[model samples]
Target: MTDVPAPPTPVTALLRAPRHRVSPRARLMWQVAALVEGAVAIGVLLLVDLAVDQVDLPWWGVVAAVAAVLAWVAVVPQWRYAVHRWEVTETAVHTQSGWWAQEQRIAPLSRIQTVDRAEGAVARVFGLATVTVTTASAAGALEIDGLDRARAQDLVAELTLKADAVEGDAT
Candidate 1:
């Protein structure tokens, strides 16, 4: 008698669309700066309040700082979200982003010539980095920045391997 074959395991919904998000600290520094500015503004109000012995004009500085801080707070989440999403599929690496409008960019493995990484002051603080992929097509060099460093390196290595495989297949 022939034995029955085992059923295939189902893929996890989470892994179906694998995506890497940017480090929270990638945009936290700017938000923190906004908060500090707001605090300084409060201090300025207190000083002005003591100097004039009148409740006038000091409120305006506080109001302006609060408004600015509020605006930054409101806007940061979307920017951070946009910056975070980076994904690679079997065929291409996809970058989806934008705030007011959405943008999607795709880079095929065969076209990629080099993959590099970068780090800056804020990025270092967040332990975040950048990955730049170069292509022969010359579309002004697409760059994916503000990623966690180890993740970026792993992506680079995988893409490099895929590129080599594709090149070998072509020849």
Candidate 2:
């Protein structure tokens, strides 16, 4: 009997965010930065291993490696942590992200000061873009990176139109 491959896992509604989000350029940039950082970390660990070997091999070194590995149990999974999760509710945009200290941000469309998108080399290759939304709040800016450029522009236009419409209704 021919074995059929399992169907791909279906994405449930709850697991999905809005259709629009930050640009792909931004996501690519962040991902590239992460890869570079990970490489550097491995290099540092190698250096540390060499240096530690030159010194007396403390029993703690073994314990330290074990401990460090254990500690990474927490840090590693966080790399995939949702850096940006957003949804356009009727009233506002809600975002949630946190590796250690969790944070959630909400920005009403009316308060959006600017909407912009960026593209980079990776974005060019992948046809991705990033969208950033600034608000009156000094500490908060909404960025949705790693999106299709056309999609990003469409989203920006939609948000701007919505903001304008809301303003018109308020008057």
Candidate 3:
């Protein structure tokens, strides 16, 4: 007697993690982004604390703010890089993203309405780009960020071709 394993059901397939990780440089990019954001937020707090004499913020408050921002800069980027991943197949594109809260999305080729690639000023400095896939679903678009500039462009073209070849507008 032989035992055969059951095939992967759609639900199970959706639960499975995607195969590819974002570019390793994404960690550096994320870290820089965190630092920039922390700087802006901390700068604002310093202004409020220093400029507004009417509101005397405790020294601990300022210390806590710095500690929080430093923690975010130290943790978020590495966590995000570890957690975020994406993949595209003949039938669908899958993605998982986030640091604190994770989100997973699957978009089929037949349902894809548009594919776009974006390069943020900061991301461009790192030679990275994001590819966005818009689908007919009401949930909204799926974004695969932290890809190499060339890779993102290639993904956009590949998705466009695959979506175009499919028959019927997946509504």
- In model 3, state the lDDT of residue 17: 85
Which regions of candidate 3 fall more than 4 Å away from where they truly are? Answer: 1-10
Q: Return the lDDT, model 2, position 71.
A: 54
TM-score for candidate 1, residues paired by index? 0.62
Residues 41-75, model 1: lDDT tens digits: 77787777778866676567767867876887668
Clashing pairs in 1: 22-84
TM-score of each: 0.62, 0.55, 0.90
Cα lDDT of model 1 overall? 0.69
Clashes of each: 1, 11, 0
lDDT of 1 at 14: 27
- Name the weakest run of 10 consecutive residues (lDDT summed) in model 2: 13-22
Between prediction 2 and prediction 3, the one with superior lDDT is 3
